[model samples]
Target: MTNYELNMKYYFAPLEGITSYTYRNVHHELFPGLDAYFAPFIQPKQTHVLETREKKDIDPVNNSGITLVPQIMANTADNFLWAAQELAARGYDTVNLNLGCPRATIVTRHKGSGMLADLDTLERFLDDIYNGVANNGPKISLKTRIGKDDANCAQKLISLYNKYPLPELIIHPRTQKDMYTGTPRWDVLEDCLRISKHAICLNGNIFSPADHQELTARFPTEKYPNIKAMMLGRGLIADPVLHREITQNRPVTQSELKRYHDTLFKAWDALNYGTSTLLHRTSELWFYLGCMFKDADKYVHKIRKAKNIPTYQAAVEQLFEHCEPGGYFSAP
Candidate 1:
């Protein structure tokens, strides 16, 4: 859907490797309200397949009914156009460009948010993606950081974005160098809202229902009353049922959490990934899950130490059985 005509509710940000098709299916079935799922970035020019696990993340049949956007990571316009064509053939209405991934491994390739460093090249890439190739469908969305090192008065970049009629511009305000290290500049974001012609969506550091509520209330509802969408990452992963909690306007019951915890295991079991791989995947979640428990560090430690699924499950059961809900807090 075009940003202007969209309901503009909650669209998810793509987290590579972790948020797989299996993960998306499990999350959708268990806890709903996600308007769309932004699939992990699909790199261009790898004829065989872009990523190891990401191929499944973008498979159409695996993600039916879901408003899926496969993110494309490319430095050149050719790669952008090529990747967009590939995703269109694979049955996606739109594909997002990964101009916001801050992980060093990705940035070193001069891709992801790293592309922002060279605005001239960035502009040309956008030009080609929009007008260079003739793809059947697939509108493009941009997921971007504010700058290469800092926000850098990115209004100039905004003007460039305004030059085209993009579907949406999901801006994560921190630059590639910032990673997830600091608070996203809400003030810079406010400036973006003022100048941006495209409908905007916020992302970064929203960790709880309270954060969502406060931000919603703070935003002026007069002119842009309908503006209501945020792309969540580590925040949602820390508590997958967080969306449900906000909708219900109540605390999630311990039993409900256990059911979710169990569901994670069941879905993981459905895949052919080795026991170690399964455990490894669930362990990555604890960094987010640890935000929920009183003994978060110890809990993460125990979960990390477990080698087998049974051991991991036992530890998980113990943590939640005696768990006291942690308050709205975050990492340093």
Candidate 2:
């Protein structure tokens, strides 16, 4: 049940509204297991101006000493290239393109996974990226789902991806239709690993160290050696000490959780997000952290009902002081 001895590379999947500079910096300081942390996708405009929020997320001052990669979500190669040039000028050596987002709002716009439905267009887009600026600017990596409709579509995508000099192709093993439901289609991913010319990283259903073990075993070093990296998001949020457990070979301590939570809380409080706004954000975090408690439902409810910062803090304290940590809650 332990894959502690395996030398696996780790990446923190960018969860929008959650894994921003604040979360990334704190997590990086607390747990040093991750090789890189991806910033949530920044949608660049035709003007090619990085938004204030996007600029802040990639600010060297904010992300100092953290191996952070900024992700750009653009359907067009022009928009993508413009943003890539901007990022590279900002000193980012690598930038990730988001082709994996499944939200209806994003997909309906013919972006994210929706673009995967058209091979001709997607190829042209990639061609523009590589031929135009990718050769001269920051090396671009991709985060994609298998396809927009059928998981089998990954096979064709891989054939197309093989034509490019991509450093890595991170696959989530799910079609857009699947969203976050069901299990990942590892069968399709296995085929992807077999034919992909580039290195591949698995990025789905890795909720625990054992889950990662199962994935590594299936794609063992003896056979599928190209698959070595895994991206974690909800799993890390659900158990903030997960990286420590996986990389440091340690157990999740209450003290560790307290420190992590308090760090995040104090940081958010500094933003002066207003009492209700701050409470809402903190409560949302507890929605994942609460999963580790024995009576998760009760603790989660109390955290949700909390009206102010003090009440929220009190509810969290109650969970840590009275409730034991161990449950079967999985991130959605």
Candidate 3:
């Protein structure tokens, strides 16, 4: 296989409710260069076919230009296999299992971020996947947090990972306890690269090329040299041209930002979603979009509290009117 950097894709990580086809389509239409996108974790083992909403999100008809890696949330071996089959049934060649969900509702079930806390269980989970339950596009990838709550958890987890033959290991080097609180532990990633069996794709706080450079400089992937492939989530929302910056090595222009904001607004308008719905979608995005402005916090407040579309549109128009977006990566 090609080394990580050579094979690296400027990918968009699946954020539940945020990175769906509507959002993905809108993003691609406005700002291009996303290599592949991960669909938000679909509880693969769920009792039925893709529900109305998910069915649409994963629909091949909608995602023509972009490569998509369907992501599944599995709590057990059965869940993993079931989800994989479902994706295959839908004609996907590969799938990603979320080992990084930190939400309490998800983790409490030994799914998501909680799943990483137990090595033995995780081992079994993988064994089941490799055992051939997933006949259609059995290829599986893992997206993970360092541990449930501590640094040691990642140490033990990495050892376990070294034994498996995963296609790729996407690591966000922070514990579940952090809940995105502090900086990612790069040292843990360094240790992981030394022992991991699969290709290592770095994730966590890759908002800008600077962040990407920092990881490459510190970790220095021995086999790959520079593992450029990374998963961008909040970073993309913070700055949609992130892929452009990473690949083209150029800053986004004012026209680019306005185009993105306008496209998103138009998509929402056509969907005929109520003002509250539009506000809800825009607000989730502004969590990072706020960073692009002069008075970010104030702009965020204006977008968030707007009760209706006329009000919300006026706010959005105002925010983008003066300040231009700039970031390697930014925060909520």
Candidate 4:
């Protein structure tokens, strides 16, 4: 690997309801190479107050050992400013705005990619944020899709983003309509690298070390040097050691993976309210983790089907007992 590739910063993208503080803590503990970890979006209310979950997620004490950047999902400038100040008071120096979430529920509220529908309004919103919050408190970063309905919007948003002095901009190369479907528009990213003034971190379809290597090769370091950061979400969860593998050349061993799984399971078991919640959490994680096991179909079905904790435990045990370790899917 080139020194440029080794030096590139790596961030773990926030996955709402999935990359909570607990998960971040454990992921960091088990695999300790990510430069920064972004917490899932904190949905600020009209009252300028944070929800209980939001408060806990961004609380410094909860994320003591890691560099945590709180992400805010809000269309109101007032709410965004308030949340930014509140998090700043909590010792956070950077906050990311969530403008890329493609879920129907979020966009319908005109908060995420929905804002992309009206670039003028988005421009105004960003104007307010840069003038109000970003100037006064922590540096603000943005995570956004290309547009609400089409990839062309991504091309346009690049010009819009270049207008701001944003420290970092993470672009997931799919429009809202794509919704994790189809191929990510690499053309849009290639264009973004050439046009964006801020550092552009590519986020999408990065699921393995090979994927990372291939992507960096596409945009040679000598040319697109501004594209210096990469964010991995589902891929990191699927193979916890992926960042370590790419940056440190550490291969993930089966026993190590099992230990990481066991540690996360025990942590969730302790904090989660009931067996059902615990099962739900672990099952969702296993959905990606199952990819690392050979013949994953054999036990993955059982892991997904398990109804209770004991049943889930048995299924997991059976997986480690029988299945060999290899990987399943390459993307989330």
Ranking by lDDT: 4, 2, 3, 1
- Assess candidate 4 and give its lDDT: 0.86
Model 4, span 152-249: residue lDDT tens = 76768989988887889999989999988777888878888888888888899888888888888887778987887899988888888888888877
Candidate 1's TM-score? 0.91
> If both were scored by lDDT, which would come out higher, candidate 1 or candidate 4?
4
Model 2 whole-model lDDT (C-alpha atoms): 0.83
Ranking by TM-score: 4, 2, 3, 1
Better of 1 and 3 by TM-score: 3
lDDT of each: 0.75, 0.83, 0.77, 0.86
**TM-score for each predicted model, relative to the true structure:** 0.91, 0.95, 0.91, 0.97
Sequence-dependent TM-score of model 4: 0.97
Judged by whole-model lDDT over C-alpha atoms, candidate 1 comes out at 0.75
Give one digit per residue, the lDDT tens place, for model 3 in 226-315: 354688888888789877776667777877777787888778768886777888888887777677666556766988898977788788
Q: Please, what are the lDDT tens digits per residue for candidate 1 over residues 1-332? A: 23322444676678876787887887788778788888888787645346555666777889987788788888877767776777778877778888888878788888988888888888887888888544555788788888887787478777789987677889888887778877887787777777888877788887788777776666654555434578887877767766655555566566666776678778887786799888888887776776777755676688778999778878887788667676544746
Model 2: worst 10 consecutive residues (lDDT sum): 1-10
- Which has the better TM-score: candidate 1, or candidate 2? 2
Model 2 residue 175 distance off true place after TM-score fit, in angstroms: 0.7
Backbone clashes, candidate 1: 1
